[model samples]
Target: QNTTSFGLTPCPKWNPNGTTIAGNSSGLKGNDTSSLDRPIGIFVDVSDNNALYVADHENSRLMKFNRSQHQDQGEAIVPSGIISAESVFLDREKSIYVAGGGKVMKVIVSGVGETILDGETEGEIGFHELSMTLYGIVVDSNDSLYISDGSYHRVVKWEKNSTNGTLIAGVTGEYGDDSTHLDFPHGIYVDFDYDALYVADINNNRIQRFHPIGNLTGETVAGGNGHGNGLGQF
Candidate 1:
């Protein structure tokens, strides 16, 4: 699910009225296991019959929806321990990773969750700290994790089995619309082939592409013309 192949041309038209495969069609919200509350992040497991995993934010849990069975109600896989789970990611090993409560946690299906990166813990890098206001989580092919720290206004890279994270994009604790900065970054994606990272600069209303190898500054690939209803706006 983490890997993506785009086949559409630029400015491709999409269906405005999309069908709802899971959750209430009427936009109803509930805390019940059958329903979801403030689901923030979703990952589709293509290998697992296209099963969808959602980070139920307000519910503080992870929900799994099986598309093969046409199930409307999602099963609570990780029921608790992740307060305000903002994002979820699944590695090739089938281990689930969650970002919430100022930490990144790893949980196996039907098992307890373990904190892999805690904000309170001192990072191995100099003066770098993981913030509680984490939004998106994605793992690269090398098993390293990339997370968007909303409060810190930057994206961090945590190597496998590493306690500290390296600042891959944006300045630490700084927010801006400049190429060298980011404002409340949300979702993140890694293009392994290009060796680049794409970040959803939420407040900046743009998508940025950053090369993690040697360059920290980002190039605006789309939507930097301010927020509006225009076709080029975001």
Candidate 2:
């Protein structure tokens, strides 16, 4: 669902033990259409009857699990050509965005896939020139894409039908724990109402918030102290 609210709503206290709504309860991995192998990214399409879309990474495809039906098996939606699918996002129009294999693809529910951004290919207008190892992807209300380029250690914003992407956070090819730097950024989320971008800075073990309006340097929102099992640690 599209939201215009800023900041996160505190989740109500619930049971610590959670139920497995999809996939095998034993955590077994499989390559079949009914099972998932190294599924990395997931998006719940609340608008579409709460259908859960998964980036079936190792299987190189996308899977859709219907919540209403409470099915254990997921239907393979985009059945092929999404090698090492790392992340998946669904826009307001129900268009699917997939990130994998140094490329980002746009796919419809009917299974038509189009490569919109190819990091391996060069010299194409509106295509990124850098070799991107994409991890996370989120599309804004305007259909602009915010992607975490793991190889580049940065986050970039690709305007809808634009020439190239603009750097949103971190420096290209640089990694650091400083405010202006990031290391192997993974998941990314855009708050439309806040006009901010949240990044899971993987290597740095922190979460960063970047405001595209004026500030290029980001602020640490969580887990910047150090890696540990204790509180306030990553």
Candidate 3:
């Protein structure tokens, strides 16, 4: 059986901070325009003990919850400002970053959502594809974003304060052949310690990695062909 609860700190909410789990207990109601029915996840605000934020993707909004304060204090930080968000990241300064619609956008705590990076959104970059859809997004300590262009079969880096993106992975025009190129790149995670990147190459049914500076790339740290519903098994 599946059991869940919304509270200051609850089970299966992933990580628990000093206080609340950071979720909205208010169920859907009549005339509720915002898409609160499907909440993705709750993000904690490190600045304040009681402050927590939830990504209401369908509603295209981000709202904050403060445990010390009553439900009345709940407020939408960025309202109706996102479209089909797949992943979200919160920086140390409480800045919320969202990746969707083949682009990554930033919403400062002041409530302004601006298209920060996108090859198709801004001027054409090194390789622009109107069909490329972005999956996972992550920002390095340098504030540069790493994204997977699924349609192009590779990954690229969108440096901070630059409209142009340099190709970090070869657009080999194939998916999961295990050759000298990538296939259907999906999710990406930056390994700061080793200056490397891990990617979920979906179509290839595996995960791969590349050095931060490139030229030193490798194959799935865990070997599998995308058979299991969870992590790959040897």
Candidate 4:
């Protein structure tokens, strides 16, 4: 079920109709020299959408691949900064932000090295009591970050250059179907135009929206009936 394809308009020799050029029905690791295991996160380069970055989770590395070429697998970049990255977001400045291990880091691609959240010693507060698992991250127009704290069942927001984060939605230690609660929340998005935040309330099988200014509580926008592979159900 995992394969790589190309555009039909290109009309390459190997695949005239643009079918899968890599991976196979056998489900085997396509390449011996370079392969992926538990590829968890993918992000298209901000400068070029054709270039991709994959968080090779199990392999403990990040990869870069150019879609137009036949590079069976990606080239590993920033091999040591992350232990297990759950999400990646590229800002307008082309800096990469990674979320994992209850810490969000900034990795500058231009050899500036990695910078983690500053603690009190650096003259700012930090995440002393962060959730066990972190997933999904999005940076808003103002360079603020919103992260989905999976283990704690809540969404947290960290402002630009701020050491600590504020709970934007859901109550910590509480998980339920109620408007103010979240269960296994993942993949958060911020609509700057509306000043609203949307969360994929995974375990609750619904999507919820919270307004930062007026309402910190989330209201279900989709799914609530139950967990099922039916219409309107996540």
Q: Note the clash tally of each candidate.
A: 1, 0, 3, 0
Task: Please identify model 3 stretches exceeding 4 Å from their true place.
Answer: 1-58, 62-75, 121-132, 170-173, 229-234
What TM-score, over all chains together, does every model reach? Answer: 0.90, 0.89, 0.66, 0.78
For candidate 2, the per-residue lDDT at 65 reads: 94
Stronger candidate by TM-score (1 vs 4) = 1
Q: Over 4 Å off in model 4, which ranges? A: 1-33, 118-127, 212-214
- In order, candidate lDDTs are 0.82, 0.79, 0.61, 0.68
- Looking at candidate 4, what is the lDDT of residue 167? 82
Candidate 2 whole-model C-alpha lDDT, 0 to 1: 0.79
Which residue pairs in candidate 4 collide? none
Model 2 lDDT per residue over 55-95, tens place: 88888888889998978888877775555688988877778
Residue 123 lDDT in candidate 2: 49
Find the 10 residues in a row with the least total lDDT in model 2.
Answer: 123-132
TM-score of 3: 0.66
Candidate 3 lDDT by residue in tens digits, 158-183: 77897666677645344545544777
Q: Pick the candidate with the highest TM-score.
A: 1
Q: Under the 3 Å rule for N, CA and C atoms, how many clashes does model 3 have?
A: 3
After superposition, candidate 1 runs with Cα above 4 Å error:
9-11, 109-112, 121-128, 212-214
Candidate 2 at residue 98, lDDT? Answer: 86
